[model samples]
Target chain A: MKRSFYLKIFLFVVLLFSSALADAAEVYYLGGPQGSSQEAAVNPSYSLKQRFQDLFSSLSSIRKDPEASGSISGHLSQTVVHNDIGGNREKSYLKPGVNYITDLNFSIQEKLHADYNFTGQWFLRKTDDPRVESRRDVRLKQVDLQVANERNLYQFGDFYGSFSQFVLGSSLEGFNMDINPTDDQHYQIVIARRNEADTVANSFQRNVFGFKADRYLFKGSDLFSDFRIGVQAASSQDDSASLPDNHTAKDLRNTVFGLDGEIVFKQGLSIQYEYAGSAYVEDEDASEKTTTYANAFRFQPSMRLGKANVRYLYYYAQPKFYTDAGSSMSDKIQNQVSLDYRFSDRVNVTVSENYYWDHLKGSSRTKRTFNDEKYMTWNLLPLASRRSFNLRPYVNYQVRNSDDPGNSAESTTLTGGFDISDRLNAHTNWGVGYECRSFIDRVTRSNSEIFHRIRFNWAQDMMLWARRLYYAITPNVDIRHRKGNDNKDVTVGAGFNVQYDLFQRVFLRMGNTLADTNSASPSGDYVNNRGFWEVDFLVDKERSAHFIIRGERNNYTAENGAQSYKEQRVIAKFEVNF
Target chain B: MRTKTIIAVLLTSMIVVGCRAVTGAVVDRRAVAQESLFSLAGTLIKDLFDNYQDFSMESFRAKVAVDFVSSRNDLVNNAASNIRAAKVLDIDFSLDQVLSDKDLLMVDLKWQKRTRPYDSSNVVLTEGFTQAVFKNVAGQWLLYQINKDNPF
Candidate 1:
């Protein structure tokens, strides 16, 4: 009864808020239109007939809903540079060996009712390499489909579970992820050195797929709920070729299964229990088949008083691994207790302490994994009374263990940040922290460090014929001090950006950034100083056509007392969205 | 230095015209006003029950310094005798929400009662009006739309 009461209150408040929003403003303000040169009135109720006509005239509306609709776009870039170092002049050309990048997406959403809806999207991309690629080439990007349903499946305590929409389920909607392009190459291989006639046709294919889905059952209740769940499983596989004798391939497969249930008591409190397990297989060693699994459970109790909301969550997960040696397990526990409190109208404070513990097996090892379990308390305070001026202060503290060693290692740090005037801004953050650790045979070392960063920035808008240009200057200083080592670095950077509309459908932009670091290592050169410049020209005509041309130059100082090296590149692309 | 100055001047001119700075303020003010009204209206409706007794449209009209004349549902002998009469004396109204440019006003009306409703126990009949209008002197919203049984 108490749980339901809370649910009613929650729904009532949401309803009130929505109505308030609607009656307060006839239409929502979401900024300017696409490629708009000026901000204009986007009133939805300006004219009901006109609004409907605009909607009907949209490209998406004309295409009609289908099982899927997507497109693929790719571009190519080339760079040629001449290097004159040590009196030796040489020219090197860099371009894509096989540049092909494409993205194909499709979605199908069948309307069930006015109140109940189901949607899904299928997303895929092909690329050659993600880390580094020529303007024209890409790598095995991604491919995945997702589906979701609302009020269409089973409902548990305030949760829903659907089995038919897991990851790659029939519902493919709302799939958004970054992807690189893909390039494919076909070749013929000789099965036998002497049997040229016995050649076999070969093709290289690389693809990555990621998806997320949940089957919610017995959901939307305040108390006592159960769910059957599955997901696309976060997994990836890659195969790439370099020079001869340099081939790398990887295959990772994962299948996830889970069940969850929740119980809401009469006191407006609830506890949720979830037991999920996954089987992950990777192509690493044939002799050793690796398997990893995890189970987690969380409990949350919440209360709302007027405009203030208070809630707490307690979560625990035990991850287990199986290897050829035997079965081993570890307990990873994260305990976070925080209160999100609002003070007045302009101040928000989030104070919380997080304790993470990763204990392997039953042994109490002094040194944990790469990131050891520690007790940390973080404080964030933000004050934004207006859009022009903002201030945020943060502090962090980590508890020290006896096994840790460092010189002058303190476990506390305090930092402050501030931003002023939309045009001019300044920020500074400083922290003092220490680390203590024990080495072999009970020998301990403690280290103390102080870090500080200060920067000031200024920017202003410039008017160009039917365009806007912006310029900014920033000066930065970084200071670090250890028990015995001290370092101080100062950098002055300037950047300029200009965007102009040459025609109704054409726009041009030029930007440049130059930063010069003036700190010399005990021995010598400031190798970190860099300069970059880029310009882009774009022509856009609604859904009809878009053309883009961009060129960039990067320059860096050499560390070996040699002349600086620079690389320049240019690219052009065209796209049509309908 | 001279070239930089010229470029700056040219850039500034271009931005001011391209962004339509002249019209930006007009659009922004309207949006801000609309948003403020929305938030305020939401708060008032959520707490309307608390002010039901004192919220009256007739009194609100009077408080706005507007004279009102009402025709009762029951009459006797075509005279003022046995006829329910309502006259707004003093009202204090605040526009809690206003949408459609300055056209529609979501008002929170507070006024005194001259003739009480027969069913005084029913809050809906006593203080049912939460929204009003100033579209015109006569065609203005005088009755609460919540009472759909009568459209007057």
Candidate 2:
């Protein structure tokens, strides 16, 4: 009797909440790395991310004017993660990290054309334990400030609107140094629970200050056109201190200056130019200088045809003295041209080409003793062709010239893809490239590769009372051939991911991938299999408050050996934006 | 489960058939309207560029400046919106007739337009445009393709 009564109450509450959601606006939330989202095994689920925005806006409106309405919003996201790998080695870790961001924003404007706006945000972050390397704890804190003054102007020839004709800004940021991920030698990546005494921790403090100014030259449509120019200056200070009180490092100072300008020609030819430079200073033994610059020009003769773009740039950097003694001074020049063509609604193509020439002058010690100086003389140029069909199918090809030393001897790559029917898609690519003459003699290598992929996708928004599921099957094969070597390898892989949205704000996802490779070995033949698994669960109360738990496991097995690794992480986030 | 699958397919087919009927009519209208717009915009641009001597930088600037001042006044008085000025102010210099076959028309347009600076006191122009296609639909003109470089 008690269980039945509880069940009845739950059903009633669910019905009431769902009815409320049916009347709210719909907004989809897409969160992923690198500004793009991946397809899931289940259909795309729509979340009420938009409803939150509408709710906030309405709340602000209700409290407007008489109340001078405003809202302070923030988000706190923290993750606890663990990783495990075994080989008779017992290792454990409890790494914890938290990122909290808060912003204060408000606006007050009168009937006048001028207004003042201010926005500020604070970001605080801390990492307690690092996995790849031994580290105790690190923290970073930063603050941003933005203020602008805008006014209505009738001086610009044909433009209409109020502009921020002038502005001023400054900021301060600092963080504790941690591990470097780009390039770490084998000696730096060791993590052993049994050897805690040999581990060391080091950290650094950094700060930066900056300022900027902008101004307009004239207004109105004239043969001379409208113009604007901006200038900025910034500087940073770095101080490092290692553990065990070994030594106190000198402060490193860096300064940068920049300038930018834009011009509109009466003939519709618009040109823009910008330049920036930086200088670094440290102890007499470890100081260096560097600079970078770029220029671009575009033209459109009429409205029907597209624009033609041309760009050129040069960059030079001199090697440092202490740690980079035998290094060389490097210089690089690049040129590019592109044209956009629109044939019709269903067809379009863009043609582009890029050429680069680089030179390195060996240092005195390297010039006399090292053979690298002879290898420094080289150039590289690549020609690219691209075409798009019906906005859904596309093809691209690239050819390279290799006589320039740094370039491949002769190489060509082609990729073509199409959507077959509504549920199937396929892509294929192949490339053949040769090693430069210099490397050909030593490595004696030429390479050929072929890749093919096909995927089938099916999704529906409505299924079994608002529940949605999306699924896809992707299979790919890659074949590689090498010269001077009788052995070759072919690899085939497939992956699938799916999300099942249950009720209003609860969901679960599961994904897996498998890869198999067949290789002709020096002794005979070999096969390797690699697979991975992923699972995640999430819940949101109001779209602004959320909780997520995710885990991944990967395994690799071969005829001779096998290895398995796993990771688990959980994150809780909440925010309210106005 | 098999019955459910059949029902789902039947429902989707019904919806698709309904959509197709409506789309068929729209396609015909769009085809004609797009053709007409393309022809008019293309021809105008080509004629302007062909007589570039009459529309030199000095003359063009003078005309735009005068027109801008008047438009600004009208906007302040709430008599007009910025769109009116934008339409009258669009100027293209690179004009080439690339397609005039069949009943459809296509042309490439490359032109530069000066924009009002954030301060409104200064003007900066950027040069850009597109090759556009037009089709006449239901006695109305519509645009199909618009790009900076020549498409066809």
Candidate 3:
């Protein structure tokens, strides 16, 4: 063994010397070096400097070439976690076990020929745990690629496509293209899977296709600063056969078309409108599948005048309207208006009202409900000195009325709150808030209730032993009273946190919260405590290490018995970026 | 002589009017450019809020960076719960400040929102100022980070 080791050492030395000799030859061929050719040949120190200079110059030359330049940046993280639970294991949110997780993410960008650029992103995650399925233990979360120029872009693998709110808006694993044919024309096309495939369960998948186009008019006109009109269409179908079982598949088929327009004037007025129509089939494979047709529209206008701003919105959707990729509420009509004004540099006010109704088709079994909401807020400095303190006060009220022949009902809610804060010094500050709320039910008096809540907080930053230390303390209380039984409930909570710079490169943070509640009902009574401490070490600009410990305990006293649980977890993580 | 004087006056008037017209056109062009940029930023921000309000995770994910980090730990779980628990009723915002770098845009704005929690009957009003950073990737601005508080 000794002989072999010595032989290896000798071979390594010989190889190293050979490489150095080759480098010296290259320097000689480059005219003996830069800045001092004679000295570089005679003096070893000067020759070393010249070699480094040459190396840097070549590297810089590579960087200067735009087409040859590329960047690779990424981060790697490894984490180990442990969790423990005691008392009523069924009530615990997480399993008791040890887990090891590794995450890797990176991005690459390169400039190609013909003024085109290429970008690629990749993400990978792995976790080891007995309860986790093997297929899920290791996963490729995302992989995306793109090639783009000034006016056009092409993407594949995984991309996010958004054409319009009511037509097509979602992320998909697909191919997408965006083309700007002229300064005033734009178009987009997308074809992709709407949902990720579940190979383990053999779940169904949705396939979607979308197209959109827009044209701009009066771009630079003083009367109409920006005017644009657009049209979008989308279609999706669920593959029932994709899932072997097919029991949970919806087998849905949907198609939507939309038209939208927007106009902005130089005089600080803007208006936007959109209309959409949809055809949907809930169960495509069923024997008597029925198709539904519905429509929806939205109109919004806003204006700015002097120190005031006003906005209005109107929205309506038919009962059967449905779009999986967009936000649409069916059988509804809504109208909203708001105004904001600035009285001075130190004071501002805003008021808004919203009215909405549901069950527009008036189905016999479904109750039609109307909701009205009003809100007002004020921001004020209150004090004569603008820097002394700040105050914000707000009020909100809402009413709901339901009509159902003989079972009509109405409810109202009012909430008022104020928040006050002040800075005592450069390193200390404090804030306090109070809120009162009341809910009244005309038909069901038993459901009426009132709530009062108060909160206080203080924060301080100090220099202790020439290091920075910061801490905050918060305490709050909430009380509730029910009208029918005169029952009362109360909850008190407190939280404290401290952060200190333990060393030049190390940071320490610890925080805990405690809450106790006493309610009329046994199920609502509980004591909860949670605490956590974390330490972070900055190894360098591109590397970091973190250690975190967390614990939680909850004690519940119910009518039947006491259900309690305690959990503790520890995690250690190291991350590096390149 | 009188005819020559009249001709000189007409020439001077034309020169002054032409200069004014050119100056006006230049100013208008600059204003239009500025307005377009602001409009673009405004639309992006509005779209983000709409997605948040709708609780569309896929659409929201597309607007943010892949390696997005937050000051609050467990950003993924917290974001999910926050979205599920709150129903946004109304939102108002003003984009008064925007700073541009090579591929990054930083926006500072004041905003107000009215929201109702799933378990609560009362609507809560909140107002604050926040700063958001967006990076241009393939001609699209993706949210990089937020300072102060995250609304979504």
- Global lDDT scores for all candidate models: 0.32, 0.32, 0.64
Docking class of 3: incorrect
lDDT tens per residue, model 1, A1-578:
53464345435433433332332222113332222244332222224454344334443442443222211122222323222222101211223233333433333333222222223323234444221232334332212222112111211110011121111111111222211000010001001010011112121122223332223334444553433232222222223231123323333344443333445544444444444444556643235767555444444455544545555545454545211111112354545555566666556665555555555454355543221222222222233433444444443344423324532222432323332324133332222222222111112222343444444555556566746555555544433343333453333444455555555556666666554444323322232222334333333344344556566554545333333345454544454444
Among these predictions, the greatest DockQ belongs to 3
lDDT of 2 by residue, A273-360 (tens): 5444445565322455332222212221221234333322222332221100001122323333434454544344444344443333
User: What is the total number of backbone clashes in candidate 2?
Assistant: 65
Question: Scoring model 1 with DockQ, what do you get?
Answer: 0.02
On TM-score, the candidate that comes out on top is: 3
Give each model a TM-score. 0.45, 0.45, 0.70
User: Candidate 3 residues B43-121, lDDT tens each?
Assistant: 8788877556533222355588632322111232245345434445445575544444335565656676655343443
Candidate 2's error at A331, in angstroms? 1.0
Q: What is candidate 3's CA lDDT for residue A359?
A: 80
Q: Encode model 1's per-residue lDDT on B30-149: one tens digit a residue.
A: 111222343454454334321221222212212231111111110101111101121111122322123221223333332212121111211011212233322223544322211111
